[model samples]
Each structure stands twice: as C-alpha cells, then as structure tokens.
Target: MEIFMETPTAANGGNPGKKKRSWKKLLLWLFLLILLFSLVFHFTSSLLFRKTEAGHLKFITPTVAQFRHEIAVRGDISSSENQDIKCRVRSTGGVMITWVVDEGTEVKEGDTIAVLDNSTLIDSLDAQQIKVAQSEAEVKAAENNLLTAKIAKEEYENGSYKVNLQKLVSAQIKAKEERDRLAEYLQHSKILYEKGFVTQSQLEADIFSLKQAELTLRAAELDIYVLKEYTHNKQTNNYESDIKTADANLSSKKSVHLQNETKLKDIQQQIEYCTVKSPSDGKVLYVNETNRFGSSEFLVCQGAMVRERQTFLRLPNSNKLQVTADIHEGKISYVKVGQSVQVHTDATGDKIIQGTVIKVDENPQPTNHWMGNVKEYRVTIRLENPEGVLPGMTAETKILVEESQDEKLMIPTHSVFEHGGKYYCIEKKPDGTLTPITVELGHSNDKMVIVTSGGLTEKTQLVAAAFENRELISLPELAAGETSSPTIRPKNEEISGDFNGENSNSSSPQAGMKPDGEMGSDGPKFGAGEMGQNTGMPGEIPAGMNGMRPGGPRPGGLRPGGMRPGGPRPEMDKMEQNGEMSAGMGENGFPPGMDGMTPDGPKPGMGMRPGRPRP
Candidate 1:
C-alpha cells in the first residue's frame, strides 16, 4: 500500500513500552491464577486423605518366650586380701620418691619395691650422731664428777672426820696431864712453907699455877665434848649429802644420754623405711590414686611427694580374687548373698569366671553431688576360678536373680505405659483400629516384662512403644484416686500451630482463636487486608490493611485514627487485646498472611507483591 508496509512498531502501537507493560500484566495474572489453583488443590487433598496418629507407631505380636532375670553391673577386679606397702617414714613435709619398681612386676618377699630420697634423713642421722656423741661426753664428765663427790664423802667420813677427832683427844689428854702436875707442885709448896724452906710469895705462885692447870683441864674436856657431839655429826652429814647429790647427777646424765640414743635410733629406722620392700610374694601394684575429679597426683612416680602412711604400693594375694561392684538402689533389693554370678574381666579377655556373692552392703555408697538422687550399693563377689584375672582390671558381673522354667507371654518394657495408677498397652483390632487395654505385669528385667493377666491372644498385635503415643490415643477413664486429665486432641486441631500446649492458649486472650475461624475452609487465607494495604499492588496505596503502612502516610496526611510513622499500629493493638497476636500466632507475633513480609522487606518466598514501585 503506499502502502509501504507499516513499520512493525507502528502496526501494534506507537509506544512499544505500553505493549510490553500489558504483556507483563497478563503474565502476572496468569501466575496468580495458577498459585490460587495450587492452594485449592492442596487444601482438597489434605481434607480427603487425613493422616492417623497410629500410622506411625510400630506394632508387635505377643508370644510365649523364656528369658533370664539378671542384674548386670560393671566392677573392678581386686584381691580379697592385700598387703598395703605404705610410706612408713615420719616426715612433717612429705618425702620425695627417688625410685619405684614398675607396676605389675612380680617380686619376692625381700625385694625392694620403692626408694625415697633419703638425703634429708641422712643429714638428720648425722646430726643425731653428733648429739649422741656430745651426750656421751657429757655423761662421762658427769660420771667423773659423781666419782669425785663420792670420794670426798668417803674421805670426810673415814679419814678427815676421824683424824680431826683423834687430834682433839690428844690435846685434851696433854691439858689433863699439865693440870695434874701443877696440882702436885702446889701441894709441895704448901709442905715447904710448913718446913720454912720457901717464902710465902713462891707458895702463892704455885697455887696460881695449880688454878690455871685446873682451868686448862676444864677447857680440854669441853673441846673433846664439842668434837664428839657437833663436829663429827656435821662432817658425816656433809659426806652423805655429797653422795646423794652425786647419785642424782649421774642419773640425770644417764637420762639425757638415753634420750639422745633414742633420737639416733629413730633416725636410723626412718632411713630404713625410705626403702620400701615387698612383704610377700606377689605382683607389685603402684598406688596411682585419683581424686574426686578423676585426676591422679601420680603418688608412686619418681620425684613425687609421698605422705606419711599413704599407700604407695600394694601386694595382692593372687590366689584369692574378688570383684567389687556397685548395684543401683532400684535393683539392689533383688540381689542377695550366696547368689551365683558370671564375671567377665577386661584383663582375662573372653574368659567367664564363675563367682558367688559374698557380701551385700546394707547402706548405699557415698552419693556424688553431680549424680543427683541416684543411690548405689556395694556388693562383694568371690570368684571361683580366677586364674587369669589380675587386680585393678575392669570386670562386668551378671548376677542371676531368677530364671523361668516355663514359657510365658513376654513383652518389651517400653511397650507398656502408666496412665492413671494403671498400666496400658495399645492393642490393634482386626478391623485396623487401635485401642488401649489394661495389662497386669509380673516380673521384669532390663529389657522384657512378663504379662501376668491381660486376656490378650497369641496373635494379638500391640504397639511397640505405647508410651510415646499415649497422649494422642483415646485412653480409659482415670482410676478412683487419679486426678490427671487425658490430653486427647482432635485430628484437625493437632495441626494447628501452638508450640506450647493448652496452657499457653489460655494465658493469652488473642491466641485462643477458633481453629475454623482462623484457618477458614479455603485454607490459610492471605490477603492485603490482614497485612498492610501498601504491601500489595505497589503503586497505589489502599487503606484496608490491619497494620502500619510501609511508606509515610496516605495523601491526606495523618488522621486521628492513623498510626504514626514509627509508632504502634492501632490494628495491632486491637489484635493484641483480642489475643489474636499471641504466642499461638507463628514464631513472630504477626498473622500467617503477614509472615511473608518483615519490617525490613519481603522474605525469600514471594518477592514484591504485584506492581510497579511508587514514585
């Protein structure tokens, strides 16, 4: 045509941008229709084919079986009788270990098991020796002094006292003789006067001499008396006192020497104790003990400080073996003395040693703070054949409580659940329906329990783990004194999104919405009215949404009923008051429709809700 063929752009419209926009609009409508169709199909499928809670449970058929009733416990193999080689040294601070025999080394009675650092003890011995020597010298000096004292006492008593008395007696005798001679002269003078041969003065002189002689005799007698009565007694007393003092001094010196000798002996004994020797013929076990924290101080290692009387090694009687195991309080009641046991020691490999329970503790073992209220009792087991077993080895013991001679109906312990003072088991009917039945249990071990009375047939199938689905199934009425309620929920309501149970729904007003109302027949209704109006069809902002607008306010500016830019939304407050925005609402407090949008922007699922960006 002059008709020059219209340009391809001109045939449709002058504006290519408008045509492209229309195509995009058509594509958007197509996508929305498909999404809506999928939603409807999904809802229809869910309603038609509902899942049953019992479908996930595993079922087991009850059968007659025989199983042993036993209590299994782990223990350590030890000796019934042991000679503890302990540190016998008496040191204020601990002694340092110099050398120690390797653990598990067999040795004879006289073999040295350990050696301590005796350098300090050696120094003490040397010092004690010096003290002994000093004490000995002092004792010798004391002995010499005592001898001198005794000799002085003896000389005073036997020689000096007697000699002095003899001298005094001789003087007294001489005075008496002088007195007698003077008296005779006086008598002669008187005779001469009478004969006129001498003058009167001479006679007077004789008389005076006689009187002086008499005085001298009197003095001599007094001296003799004084010597016998006073001087002799005093000398004897002094000698006796000297003897007593010497004896006392000698005794004190001897006591001091004895004390020093005792100290020297103690030091020597301590030095001997530094080298620990095996007391019997057995394997040596080093006492590497641990604390409450399970960490050891390596007490038997070289250079380690060993306390006085702390056990550093042990010599176990290999001929007599035993195991010490701890039984829990729940199972301890079933264990009794004389019960047979099978012990499997880690050291003896696969060998099973037969043993008998010898002792059962009446009281529980010391409780650990970290273990809570659990209590355990100690049990001693004497092994019958323990040839290959060694001390300090880990062993597992299985104590035979009882055995069933006849076959009985047995089920797993987990298959039974306690409801309200009664045990229950989920029984499957022939019509594919599951129902709860009361079960009377008898004896039980760790794994299986015997059903005493249940009226269940051999072909009856029961849930393997009834306790897991107890809350979901309809259970029988509570027993007479039971107060707990059965938490049976409707099938459709179980899928409703309340993380916490009924308590959370009742506590918050808004969260307790009727399931049918919140989730309509259409299945999870999502629209702009529930989210923000501006959130959908981007360009033109509509006003019916229940939250704050994404942009500032609508064109008319802020209204009295409108929420501020960053303030709380009035609709949100209403939702909170009505309990609609409670914890039952998803993880975030918003409605399910608004779950796709966040404060910052849209989440990964549906990007921008339909339209162009606003200018």
Candidate 2:
C-alpha cells in the first residue's frame, strides 16, 4: 500500500515535465514557420521587382530653362491689287462664240479682245423693222378717218341749212304767183259767165291747184326749222365722237411705232457690244481652274458658252507682292494684325522675305477631305521686298507666335495630366511613396509646358506620365498567374466569394477561379470556336461556360462541385487533364494559327509542354 501511493505522486510530477517539453516544441515550430514565410516573401518581392523600364517609374527632375515657340504654316504668293475682265452684254437670245483674243495677250485701253456671233440679234432686228412699217400704215388710216369726219361736220354747220332756207323761199314765191294767176283766171271766168265765155268747173280746178302750191311752200319752211334744232345736235354729236375716236386710234398707232423703233435701237446697241474692249492696260495671265476632283480644265475658251457676266481675264500686279498663309485654327490665336512674318519661296532661291500680317480672316476656311479636316484661317502677309516672287508660287511662312528667355521652369508636356478640371502630377519622394501634387500650367509649345505654380523646385522629381502610377507592384503580382490553385485554409480562417467567383471558403470545393473569368488570359476564349459568352449552347444554363446561373449556386450554372455535380470544376487549373488541354486553353497556350500573332511575341508554334504550363 505504501509503494502504490509514492508511484502515483511520481507519475503526476513526470506529467508536468512532458507537458512543458511539448509546449516548447510547438513554439519552436511556429517561430520557424513565421521566419520561413517572411524570407520567402522578401525573396519573391525582390526577384519580381527587377529593374525593368516598366518597374522603374519614370521620374524627371525639373530644370530652369528657356522656351521659344513657333508655328509652321504653308502659303502662296498672290497679288494684292488685281483686275478682272468680264463679258458685258444684255441679250435675251444666248450669245454664240465668234472670235476671242488668245490668252496672255497684252491689251491696252479700248482694244478689242473678244467678239460674239450677232446672227441671233440681227434676226430679231429684222422682225422689229416689219412691225414698225405696219404701225405706220395704221397711223395713216386713222388720219384719213379724222379728215372725213371733220369735212362732214363743216358741211352741216355752214352750207346745208342755208341752201334749205333758200329752197323754201323760192317755193313760197311760186305759190304766190300761182295764186295770182288763179285769181286772174277766176275774175275772167266771172266776166265770161256774164258772156258765157268760160265754165264754173274750170275756175274751181284752178283754185285747188293754187291751194296745193301753198302747202308745198309751208312744208319746205318747216324743214329749215327741223334742220336747225334736231338735225344740228345729232349730226354734231356724231361728228365729234368720230373725230375723238380717230385721234385716239392715231395716238395708239404712233405709240406702237415708237416702241418698235426703241426695240430696234436696243438691238443695234447690243450688236455694237459684240466687240469686246479692255477697260485698262495690263499684262494678261491665263487662268486654268482646278475642278472638284483636282483635275485642271479650261473654263474660258473660244467655243465655251459664256454667260452674261463672267470674268475670263485677270491682270495681276506682281510688283507689289504678298503671300496668303493658311494658319491652322489651333495656332491662329497667337497671330495678330501688324505682326512681323517671315516668308520663303522655292522660286526665289528660298530667300527670306520680311513681311507683316496685314489681315487675319475671322471665319475658318472651308475644309476638304484632302486637307484632313484641319481648320485654318486665311492670313494675308504683305511683303516688303518680293525679289523675284511671282503669283501662283508656293511659299512657306513662319509666324513668331511667342518667345521667352526669362528662364521658366518647364517640363515635357507628357509629364502632366488634368483631373477634375485641375492639372495634377505625381511627385515621388525619397521613401518611394507617390504624392499627388497640384500645378498650374502656363504657355506651352509642342514639346514642353511651363509650370507657373507648384511646390516644385529644380531638384524635385515627378512622374513623367499618369500611367507611371500604375507601374507599382500590385496584389495581382502576388497571385501572379491566370490560373488559380486550391489552397487549404486554417479552421479559424474564413474566405469570401467575389463577384468574379474568386476567393471563397476552403470548405467549398469550387473556391477560387481565374481573375476576370474569361476563357484565358493569353489563350483562346471557350474554345477554337470563340463562342459568345451569352449563348453557351441555348437553354442549358452552363454555369462555368457563360457565367449564367439559373437555379444554381454560382455563375455559368456551376454547382458546388463543378460543371457536372461531382466532376472537375470549370476553372483554369483543371483546363488540362494529364496531358490533354481544353481547346480554349491550348496545350501550347496560344490559339492555333492566330493571324494577329506579332513577330516579337509568341509565334505560330508556341504553347505548353508536358508537365509545364504555357510560358
């Protein structure tokens, strides 16, 4: 009984020592694991960040320097004072070409330079003459009608009434005579009755004859009264109306004749205008214009249909020369009137001509396809000495836009970027932390920009471009591949799933997937077919195929296991089975026979080997 009690006590003491030794061993292992992990991380980081152009962020040290700016513009020599000769004729009938002076003929004032066919105007003139003759005959007929009416009116007023009164007087005389004779005969008959020498019936007949003569006399006298009252008014009114009508007709006929005569005069004037004459004296230069297709054709020719008014001759004054420069719209703001300009021409042995900007067009010049849609303004430069410059010759002009020798702190234009309507730059400190810096920009040329205000010095270093900020080592570099591998997690640690089906709990069989889950990073998509992501074979909601999840756990209808409930997961890592690889994830890594393959990159025969993945 005494030995059993002592044994229990000794065993209990040995248990404490074992527990202490086991705790020590656990601590040593944990320490070793932590130290190994730290060493591996450092090594990998150092190896990955080799001094590549990409890895080495571009940093430029600003310097105090001077910047001079200029713009190059193309121009052509032209005359400041020019004269144009145009056709001048007013003819309804079109003008036909007869003869024209040859191009470049020296002309003086009043010298005939062209002529037109006058046959059409001549025919019109002959017709107008016939119309004038007809109008004159109508005028003569109207005058004769006026004379006849006047004569009739005069005869009724002067002679006809007097002659009727005389006839009535003579009838009265005849009646008195007849009455006397009858009275005498009746007296004689009464005497004869006493003596039975005459019969009573004969004396009665003589008295009746005398009475009829008296009635005839009375009627003739009444005719005189009727002519004085009713006949006078009626005849006068008719004569007056006839005379007025004749006058109006004669006026109308005369007007028609005058109009025809005026027309004939105009036609004659147009005929005289058929002969062209020079208004001024100058050297003539022929003009051949370029059409829309850039093909040159003669617009002014002998047989060409010349319009009523068209400029066909030009006289350019080359003595006082000038150049017309097309300044690009972007640089036009720098140019101003009265600014000095330098012009050079190939015809003048490239001699520089000093000039001044005489005018700057307000509106932009019209654009053509051949001009690349570049907007430009027409700037006229008046040259001081043209030397041997001629019209139509090409010239190059350099306008002094801006110049500075004040020693401004300038950097390359590519070094700065604007954000949120403010210019910004990335400044790198000695500790390798990129700090955002705000800067104000000033005048700039094609290459350099002036930094007006910023906390920058001559020795300050800044990123050359915005893309240099992304050149840093990112978390993607830590995972360093397109394919994902299964990594078991500790019991205490939990993973989260991303929208792209990456980084899930270790308990889940399909945990991590490829970043940006397409088919491959450097390989084909889905397969050689390059199938569309949305239509992965119709109504079958393929989980891992098209990222379509219908009554499924994740996208592409992938179950907790894989494409098939308990099959290989549809991930990049399982793309290859033994040595066979999916069509999308080619065994050689590249799509077969890719036409877009570049010479510097993978060629046609490049892909993965047996055990190694594609390099």
lDDT of each: 0.71, 0.63
TM-score of 1: 0.66
Top of the candidates by TM-score = 1
How large is the C-alpha RMSD of every model relative to the true structure? 15.0, 22.0
User: Which has the greatest lDDT?
Assistant: 1
Candidate 2: stretches off by over 4 Å: 1-72, 75-83, 90-97, 133-214, 285-298, 315-326, 344-355, 365-376, 380-395, 403-615
Predicted structure 2: lDDT: 0.63
Q: lDDT (0-100) at residue 254 of candidate 1?
A: 89
lDDT of 2 by residue, 1-615 (tens): 455544435656646677689999999999999999999998887656633433477788776887666556788777888877666666564566677778757788888877877888889889988987888888899889888888877887677756765776776677667767766776777787778766778767766766776676577667666766777778789888988888888898889888988988888887887887777786665555666456664466677555567666677777887888877554577789888887888776747888899999998777654654346789999999987777778888877766785898887766665432356666777876666677887776555677889878888888776434534423222111122122222112234444343233232233333233332221112221112323344324333343222222222222231232322245534545543443333333434444344454433332444333232
